[model samples]
Target: MTIDTTKKIESLIITDQEICTLAMDVIESIRQDFNNVYYKFLGGELKVLWSNQNKFNAKASSSGDLKSPPDHSVTLYYATAIRIYRDGEDLYDFVSSRLNKYSDLFEKLNLGEPSCLFKDLEKEHFVKNFFFSGLTYLFGHEIGHLVQEHSYIRRFFCDSDRNLNASGEASEIEEIEEIEASASSKQLTRRQSLIWHVTELAADHEAITWCLFELVRQAQEEESIKFSQDDWHRLKENTLIFSCAASCVHFRFNGVKAVYPDEFPIGTHPHPMLRIEKNVFQIISGLEFFSTALGINSSKAEISKYINKGVISANIFWIEKYFDKNDLDSGLLMLGGVINNENTKKYMGLIVNEWEIIRECVESIKRYKPFNAGNQDLGLMFFDENFKKEFTK
Candidate 1:
């Protein structure tokens, strides 16, 4: 069914409490699995809220008295979720239409009907999984920023400018300075820009790690589900696809591109395409890392083959076709030359090293029995209180 694109986004005021609930559940599950003391730092403080902003975006920030421990806040704009859903639905329709057109060719070639390949595209299960995984990646990345103390680090570096008050929003002058820093022709020094880029990569790594872990945990916990080896492979492939979709949504909505250093300096976040490439690489590297770490005897070569054939090839084709048909500026496709295989391999090595550093820090924290996951429910009760009602009007 075609989604109505003509409706004013502000009038579509629905909030998916389920998405917020699932995000909390996923974070709780990860905390349960680790049971490390460090995880508790964010347990009570991290909150997810819905905002009625007309734009497609989300922001993570800290709140509470500066003297006391601050609470980390994540606001998922309603318009952002609507945009993601609409785009995803459109992509599904496009895929389904293409499959129908190719069904006759497939039959002549003795390749089963193309419809069977995407039978689940329109199903509720697929829609839920797609949004679940995508939202998890987005929310989890923000949580990563908090848990990694990026804000605290930023405060330390820009202490004079970032004196936090009780409300947690930046001071007016600080906000202006931030805007100026981002928009200025005089970019942050290379060292400062690299720090920002590394922090972003670190957050991406954490997001991918947690999302993959949660997906596997959920699959294993399913009482009625029996997954064979092939099923596990398919599950991993789907996780990657949803993760890519999440990145693409952010890239498209935010108008992120790979700006050449000569043309424009780096910003607080790495180029959007760089972020996508890293996420794709991290999934593969993470699979390899976890498989070996868990003694699963899974071959990296086999996983790479699966990714190349199943996820990477299919997504590239579909995304390119989608952008071409819509006439959207194709930053994603143009990123190929910038993030080629050699660069990806080098970045993979860097991620492994960075992960090792992060792992050591996490391991240093004493382990504890799992916290009461039920306590997280208290954080979800403020959704209505926190919703940005002004935009809806």
Candidate 2:
């Protein structure tokens, strides 16, 4: 099979006139949100190209149609987004009508009232949340990939035979143990285990952070006034979205519970819930500490007087109780390293250097149009080298 190596990859954004403006607004919002947090713990550059009213009438695959998925981009076509799978220069394939499937599932979940006016748009919010979660999951998965590069135990798991050898019936445990003696040694350290756990937690955090931003954007938009109890009910009904979204909500709720366990019952994904509780609480609590570290005090409102900037004042106290300066510094170092890594660009499949791409995107945003029925652009803020220091300092 001959591959069209000469074919140029293009960015496409698809949407009908009704939703196109809103979708574009979302695209821009997503871009700004991602860019703003580019140096944070869960931040990574995602080159999701926005294509509207895409003309490509691609067929849906049963389960595994795409041979090789592309590393860099996503295609959002008129509510139906398809991720492109690239197999070298030989093949490129995509999914068709993603919104249709999500919408169908949304209906299946019976998430809203029949009288819902922005019913279709509500589904978009849910779908957007899914994307946010997926992106976070991908980052964690990518961290897994990176860890496997140097992980001795992970290398064993990477081999199917090793996995089979590790798992056996209790009756066969003795035999497996005997066989294990003969097997090459590959042990896991506590640190390694913690690293793996943190990786997953980081991914979850990333997804939650993205979702929070999305929800905030919606809340700020007048068009999203249509979002109602029915919409919340609908969101809670979808299995996939509900699971991911619930996990985050559960996490926060758990925080409140931890402070007052007599109030709420336990739930699923408790580890994630606790972690979220800790992370969020800690970050908020530690804000004062961080502010102290940077030698900035807003208590007198002096900082605000100089320049009214968004100072995350709510969660500082919680983070301070659980976090040390070392922990903050370590996380910041890891985040900064990843943000500055030249290899991330390779993983993203960028042609013109990432720095250049970012430069261009920043320039383009000057004229960015808001996605429909909203003025989300009001929140758009650009950051460069100076702003990159926000989290680090």
Candidate 3:
């Protein structure tokens, strides 16, 4: 597969440069601790692209005396970065507004000043960091796919033709799935779908791990004032919650929910709400474990209540936006109807039950034990040099 890298479309945006810089900073931060990886910023409308000669090929059966350049590269498009930022801004506005209605409840939790935090969210630096951290998770997710060797494992067990397109968009695969009815005939299709969903979940796990690590590191580096261990932990947990909320809104705004089984089956990208719920569960569970390990008798339910407020706000925003309604009451009814559906409930339960395994997988990845060692030879590509200069000007 050949791509025309020279098809210059438009110039890069400043936000794009900042997002790329954040991603690079993350890669650099983890470079020494883990195997090296490469990144490039492509100038195109497409959001992101990961290129590798064997991206769609099965792993080699045996080691060979082969010396070649790194086979994988992660590419971020300037236009997509802009889209994410804009969508993030919209989501922040929506979620923050909704949260304000329940400001009293959040304030009672001693979780700090809700009004002040919302004010800070409007600041230029905070807004940038918000988008930056969220994009970092997304970029980390792509890197997860690479390091986890998802493509290799997938191609090894399934036919390459069953793979989704490079863009990772919904395609004719659903149509193909519909044509096959026999249980034996559908086995491969089901396997292919399951792998895709599992890989996506694996990537989400990686994103959450990296996001939490980055947030905690940022909190530790604060020098303006000293934070008690408990305070720091609270701050870290809240920041993670906020970032996860932002991510939920970000993906929800950009993605369409699968209203029909054929359009979105068990194997495609899980519903944005399910993903959000899973992240919330995992983060809260991890916090519970961490607090216990530290001998802190923190109220897990209290912390979760605060976080769930935000999650519920974001979910309501999503529901209102997607559901046609004249008022809040009608929207709530529609949301209830959707949530009560047998299919939605089944998938939600399945995802909820998988939280323990997902948490375990994330913990393992955080230890830098990805299935593949990742490619070290790729190094950092200078694809964004000109964009950086242009943006700085």
Task: Provide the TM-score for each candidate, comma-separated.
Answer: 0.61, 0.25, 0.58
Measured with C-alpha atoms, the lDDT of residue 240 in candidate 2 is 29
Summarize candidate 2's per-residue lDDT along 1-393 as a digit string, tens digits: 000112222322223352344334445454455345431222333343444543321110111111222112233344322321110000101011222322332343333221222234343344444433333333222222221121222223222233222233212111111112122243434333333333233334333333333433332324554444443333222222323333332222233223211111122112322333333332232233334443444342332211111011111112232335343232221212322334322321221222232333332322212221253332122234543443223
In candidate 3 the C-alpha lDDT for residue 265 amounts to 37
Q: How well is each residue in 56-88 modelled by candidate 1, as lDDT tens digits?
A: 555666642344454556666656555555555
Weakest lDDT window of 10 consecutive positions for candidate 2: 86-95
**Model 3 ranges off by over 4 Å:** 1-70, 95-122, 159-188, 221-227, 230-234, 237-242, 249-267, 294-297, 322-341, 348-393
What C-alpha lDDT does candidate 1 achieve relative to the native structure? 0.47
Which candidate would rank higher by lDDT, 1 or 3? 1
Number of clashes recorded per candidate: 0, 32, 0
User: Looking at candidate 1, what is the lDDT of residue 314?
Assistant: 33
Determine which window of 10 residues in candidate 3 has minimal summed lDDT. 56-65
- Clashes in candidate 3: how many? 0
